[model samples]
Target: MTNVRKGVWRMKRELYKLLLMVLLAILPALSFAQGDPITQARIFVEQKQYEKAIDIYKKLYDQNPTNADVYTEYLNVLIQSKDLKGAEKLVGEQQKMRQHHPLSYVDMGRVYLAAGKDKKAEEQFDEAIKFINGDDLMTQQIANAFSTLGRDDYTLKTYERARDILKNPYFYSGPMSRLYAKSGQIEKAINTLLEAGPGQQGMLEDTKATLLEFLGTDKKNLQQAQKTLVKKINEQPENPYYAELLTWLYTQRDDWDGALLQIEALDERNKENGDRLLEFARYAAKEDKYEYAIKGYDAIIAKGAKLPYYSLAKSEKLGVLFAQLQANYAYKPSDVATVQKEYEAFFAEFPQYYTSESIRDYARLEARYANNPQKAVDLLTKALEQPALRKDIAGRVKLDLGDYYILTGKVWEASLLYSQVDKDFREDLLGEEARFRNAKLAYYRGDFQWAEGQLSVLKASTSELIANDALYLSVLILENITPDSNFVPIRRFAYADLLTFQNKDKEAETLLDSLLTAFPEHPLKDDILMQKAELAEKHREYARALTFLKEIHDKHAEDVLGDDAVFKIADINERYLKQNDEAKKYYELLIVNYPGSTYVQVARNRLAALQTGTPAIP
Candidate 1:
């Protein structure tokens, strides 16, 4: 009886072991059932096992004929499998139960299209459109379905048929434009939107942005739009928007003269309040279109002081003229005198501007170019006394006044002003400028170690201009100062620089010559040569400046000043001597030999301008 019980227990254990083996054998198949059958079918589709997916979907469809998702998905799979007959039979079976379903006809059309039976496809598509009669929802579904199938022809016809059946003037220009662009009919796309009229004009910018997205920076589409704008202007002469857009196109093409012409015509035709002219003037200045900018500003000034933008235009015009002077560097004393009279008259008429940035330009012109340092000092001092001067503007004025003092040999007075500004604006650009100026003042006074210490801290200044000036001065002092700590030649060079700033060209020249004689083999040779070149350039001695620059370029070609000499030579030839060919040659040489030089990019740009007849971006 015990043996019989043991046999029974062993049999029970064997039965349990067999059951566990069966579960493990079918575990993966059972995992498929963990999700819905449709999910399993999708997984099979993802794996590209369409036959297996179809079998699973077929079982699901048979279980629930009312499942529209299953029905539609099964038919789509049939088409994807290239089984047009199977897709047709599925649709027919669905129609028997769902005769009023709109997607039946759409599916039939799609199936026919897949089979390349155009005649049958057209019939089914026509039936689908009939259901969309006067209904935007039906139209959208049909059109979007056709689009999903890449059948834009049927999609377009659906929209057209809907509009006719609804008897509505509504047109789908926005969507149609997208369709046209996709089909490579970009011109048609632009025209369709334009013809959509003012109700849809707000989409114009978006439409153009999309068109430009295709061919970036290719102004061909813009020119095409220009042609349309011209036609619109001719057809509707009273419309100013088209004129403005045309002007904008011209400006986009870097054709400032063209934009200027259009802007002037609009201003004359509309009798505007100088607002448009003033806006265009500022735009031209921003684009470096100085000629157009000057013309625009003059137009506003012609409106006289009675207009709203007159004072603003006059102020901006003063800066623009000074900018033109700086950009060309060809300003004569007579030019400065003319602008100087305008500046005096403006300040005399409006003393309130003394507290503004515009006042600084007058002082700069007077002191730096007009050779009237005392007049500049008096004007700035009067401007500083204003009770409502902004702290920043006051700081800037002090800094400028300090510079004038340095130029006029009042080193102690300049040091006081610089210290005042430095103390007041401790962490601002004004402070940085003041600190740099003070360091330079120290350098000028032969305090090399102290100046070097101050400049080392300023090399990391947040203001790029102050940082660069500090760095250059630091480098100049370090590179030229003798190992024995003798600074006599540097001190004389600084004094010569001061003299040059003071318009004492002859004295500065004499000092530079004496320094060269005293320090024949000194490391300050390149610096002395640069000083002489600057003095000669300032004195309108282009030939003399070329000689000095040539000496540095040929003898000191490996020095820190070599690139500077080459760049300065190119600049003089381009601007002062107007030797375009020579300027091109020098710029090319610098670009070739000094590929890593700071001036290489500017030289390349200038070379481009010389070769292309376009304005340099400077």
Candidate 2:
């Protein structure tokens, strides 16, 4: 009997163990049921268990009456459940609890509007606005609430009331103008924004941004803005801001001549010693408005040589002329000579400018357009000898000299110069650029191992441009070298690249084409296409460049150069072809297709400008 009892006790222990395992298996399910109450309530609400959700919310609200999230979600659930009386009671309680806070009134108004109580909703909205004491936060809350309700009219009223109570006419003008523009009251929008004139604190750029949105390549709207700005300028002739806006409007309309006239008038009226004109000229130059830029700079130069702006105007005008000629593929030898003579005359007049940026510009003109790389080398060499030259300036001179050396087929000299700058500016972007150039020189000379070694280090460079270039070159070397040690294809490709760098573009194209025919399956095909595109761009053959770039984009989009091709295509379309629509399309494509690309931010900025009808300054 005792033995039988022992067996029974062992069986009982086994049963207990089995029961404990079953409970452990179900523990997770029980834990899930006891998870976050709000989440559980939301799940129940989604399943149409409104009663359960309301119970949870009621408990939450009871625990913390001032918890806005709990109250908002609870009220939302009640309204969705068609418990109108409950929702109304909840909102009313909240209103009383907060001394009828304006936002609570807005909440009540939203409820009334939901219940088809239009009259009561309007009353509630009016009450909310009446409570506005001109406090910025309160006014913003009331206006934003009305806006959220799609009651832009009430939003305007709220702002208007706040403006009146505050006795500040320009109060909320930025937002108010947007409202006016949204309702097609563009003239009212314009007037409201400009009424405060130059005294409108921080509103000018906001107003411009608003106008950019509405005026968006609309001829009629642009004309309307122009007329309004003209009237404002006339009414407040002393308000330079009005004149500035008028000038900006003219630019938006592409009436650059009109813009220049306005700037000149402002400069003369303000007795600014051509400061404003100089600024306008610089802007025009940056926009590639060469004709008007030259005109504006000439205006400044006519102010007399002894005036503060005269020397600057002369120097800047030379830059414009050089830029104009550079951009003109069909420019004459006489045009080159004319610009060269201007540089010489300027240097003759101001010998001290040998150390200035103009000297580098002069060297670039001599080497690239004038076909005098030797002369350019000589010129920059002399500039380097200047006493007390800025280290950065000296570094830049060396880099430019290196390029001229490449042009002159002095490869070793160019490498040496780059190495000097690389050592001198060891921790600067200038140094990174110099290192990258030396690496590129190595790649050009078929020293792939050395070039790859240098590029690996530069892939972590602080300069985005340098790092991107380094990464590309490093990948190119790594990908092209076959396991069997065959370097023929990549070697020829690098040689072609070197030819292109040396301005032997025809030779480069020939070599690249031959390589394609010889090694039909080479991976350097996209690279070759990119090089050809760059060559076309250099010669201003934008259509040809687009053809090459489009091929790379369509055929090798998943490759490393995809974003580079897209950005270049967009740039060519916008800056050279003036195809704004095509430019916008490519920019948008880059942003959507290459979100992780280095060019994403620039693409977004350009796309925004294009969409807003203010194409970026190329």
Candidate 3:
């Protein structure tokens, strides 16, 4: 009976083992049927195949109808892909599956934050905190959410709450302090960090230093900033940043001695270049330290650096010192001369160092401050010798020379210079200036005829400035001369005067063409033509003007002014300009041309006057 019981029990155990094997074998197939899709979906998730993972997760949810993890993972995938609508759908799925998962709210907040829906994110974070019963990580995350939304007020409140619940002040104190500082509650931020424990003490000191440095720029806050910086230095004596800050603060307060002390300390600390010494010189100069500026420049020169900028720096310093001396002792001639000599010496030493423009400036200083026209002239001439004087400088120097001559009352010399400047160049705006000056010199010399003639040509000049000036002067001369009929003879005479003034003998001779054209039998034609001849003679164009006068004696024998023309030509050729041989023939022509005319007596008088060196009246 026992054996039969043992066999039956063994068979029962065997039967149970067979059933377990059958169940084990079927389990994988069932799981394949049920879980293969989820596994493939999870693979898709891991591989970042979001759309496929979302589709498979949705199918798995439909099949199981209660798997919250499937919906959560699907939502994560949606969030990863930045699909807000799909994430929102997963949110609904979570509500259906679990009713209240804190992760669902947190994840929804994340989606809202990613989508820039700040208010939605805030609400989701609030909901997450409630679902999690104020979990520390969740509360901190809520604070981060507020920070991301730039809601500093909410962020501060959330962090304050988190700090209280977490019982650790350091949790958000650093960020809160920064937020306070950013919001301009700097004092409060400093106090808050100072109240924090030793781990943050150094950070508080650094923050205080930065805030004080910032405030140092304001006039109202400078004293307070000074105190704060001094405290920072005393606390961290080895910190170079604090030392530099104190140096800058001193400069801001215009405390040069303090700044220098700090700079010297910095120089010792870092083995810095001597450029700081140059900067000290600049600061001293700004304080009207002329002697100190010179000393500074001399010190740099003594250093034997041989830098190009060093030369320029010394030059600038010397210029400043010289300018100060000039301004201060301008009334003292000896002082002025002394400074002027120094500047001259400096220029002589560095002749090729400075640019032409700088040299021009120095020349102006010599002219204005030292009253040395010769020095000014020499400087400008030297500038002209430079190879790199630009066209503008060349033109300006020419104009300056013309001005110098005009100022010195050498009007004729100025005119000659101006005329030699090519009209093409003179026809530019500067050229107009040269031409205008030449014409003006003529006008100033009472040579209106010459002035107007030059003006007439200038009126057609290329420069609008020259043309306008010429048109104005021509109109003025024309208006003054052509007012009446009797002035016709005066006009003819004035034409000769104008031509003589301009040294245009040929044109003066041609002006007779107008007289001959206007009145063929005009009585004054002999006088008019004779005047042309006299102008030519006066200008040493005697051969040319004499030809016209001889024609008058030969052709206008009966004319009244012919004898006068002959005698005048003889007088001009003889005594005044020393052309004796030409004088005899014109004297004879005067006696032959109009024997009964009044000029015959004067012609004989001139003949006698020329022979015996007596004045002749006609």
Best by TM-score: 2
**Candidate lDDT (C-alpha), each:** 0.82, 0.89, 0.65
Which residues of candidate 1, in runs, are more than 4 Å off?
1-189, 193-227, 230-243, 250-272, 482-485, 536-558, 562-615
* TM-score, candidate number 2: 0.74
lDDT digits (tens) for residues 51-127 of candidate 2: 99999999999999999999999999998998989999999999889984888888898899889999998998888
Model 3, 288-344: lDDT tens per residue?
756655665665666554643466665776577565764462256676676666667
Report the number of the highest-lDDT candidate: 2
Ranking by lDDT: 2, 1, 3
lDDT of 2: 0.89
Worst ten-residue run, lDDT, model 2? 196-205
Which of the predicted structures, 1 or 3, would earn the higher TM-score when compared with the native?
1
TM-score of each: 0.67, 0.74, 0.36
Candidate 3 at 268: error in angstroms? 6.2
* Model 1 residue 297 distance off true place after TM-score fit, in angstroms: 3.3
Candidate 2 clashing pairs? Answer: none
